[model samples]
Target: MGAALHLAHAGQPAPGERHRTKGKGGSGGETFADFARQVYGDQRATPLARELLLAFGYATMVAHSEAERDVHDVWSTARKAMGATRTGRRWRLDEAIADDAPRYVSSKDREHRVCEAPRLRPHPDGPDDFRNVRGICGSLADWEHYALEKQLGTGWYKYHWFCKRHLDHLARVREQLREPNERAPQPVPNRGGLLPAYFESDWLGTYRHRLDSPTWEPPVYGISADDWPTPGVEPVAPRARLRLAALDGTLLVEADRGARR
Candidate 1:
């Protein structure tokens, strides 16, 4: 998606130059294509990072053009399963598996068979193992968690799959909701739920780095559906402000920074 975005805007002039070329006639300075080529095509002048970006951009364009059918099938299926029906209700990813939780799980099982387990580690070592033996869109229904959960007879087993990036995002959201004094939950061997250690370790590394940075910032505690207090559960000050911020695409980073100041 990032590659696609980069490619989408690669042909346009830079923000500063856009005004200059707005009304230019033929042969007016450098054409937009010429400028794009100079900025994105020149191997000798482009930095290694930029060259790699251009390569990705080209690859993205090619993939979209050639794999249109496969992309459509995968995304359409996932979208429909996520409760993207004609209803006026819009799904909030921050809430995750929003609306009817049971229905969402059922749809995942019946319609989309993938791993939506937020707590599972997609890759322990590195990016190479990002996707399991099954390709990117492959189902993880036969994974250990699912099999174990089936044998144990318990709550909804997550049989949906998400890309590594989204799994990382969910991990961060979970960390943000964690109380400062909270202790990490130890997972029982072969248990079918979240393993907190994997996410905690990653968050701790980032937290330590943030503490050592020149511009230190406090952690953002954004709540998710799991953190939401239920009736007769625990009564707590609702974190609706954080959810609203996430919906508006800000995530309250600036607001939190100002509050700290």
Candidate 2:
């Protein structure tokens, strides 16, 4: 699928441009294509990673072309739909998913399938927030959720919330489509579904870096130094004293620290 997409976007090579060429070893060294081939051909690189590298190379070579624009559009749409924004932005995962109507269609049958909300970051660091959530097919979601949960049980609540919200939204959409005297809305084909593969692969190591590094700054509300206690000299205790009073005709009374002390 990635290769097909790449080819579709890449179109044809320009006049006199070589699509593939052998690299020569020596002072001239390796060409960019040679380096790309070496990276893609490395036995250590996963299939998904290799494909991502190839896609990236193709995109770069065809920069500013329609292919690049299409690729950018797809990624941009996925990012927006997944709420993959920098922290401090309002979490709008539910809103974005509802608006986008993301679905997973079976490659064999082309039927819509149940989708799951997968987290981009499995926590201690990642919060139960929209920024970490991405929509994926049920199988992939289950696998990812189980793997993460097995390793660390954190962040499940965020996944649960996202799934519930997404399901409810889908139900509402379905109901609306079934309403009498209303034309049923056409099913919007899934574009974001492929994004799960990218997320799962942690393609180009960028997502991995994002997960490992603490880039997100959660918003701090109502926090101020004024709310904290100030340090100063210790308060002095009140001293007891004797009091004397005179009223009418030289009447006098004296009070001491007796019982109070």
Model 1 regions more than 4 Å off = 1-38, 41-46, 66-261
Q: In terms of lDDT, which candidate is strongest?
A: 2
Candidate 1 residue-wise lDDT at 32: 34
Model 1 clashing residue pairs (backbone): 114-159, 114-160, 114-161, 115-160, 115-161, 116-160
Question: Tens digits of per-residue lDDT for model 2 on 1-261?
Answer: 112121111223343332332242221122335435644544433454454344433332322122213333333333343443466364233223222112222232223222444433353434543333443423322222211111021111112111343555444544543442133222222222222221122221232233342342211210111111112412212221112122221111111211110
What's the lDDT of the predicted structure labeled candidate 1?
Answer: 0.27
lDDT of 1 at 184: 27
Backbone clashes (count) for model 1: 6
lDDT of 2 at 120: 39
Global lDDT scores for all candidate models: 0.27, 0.28
Number of the predicted model whose TM-score against the real structure is largest: 2
Provide the clash count, candidate 2: 0
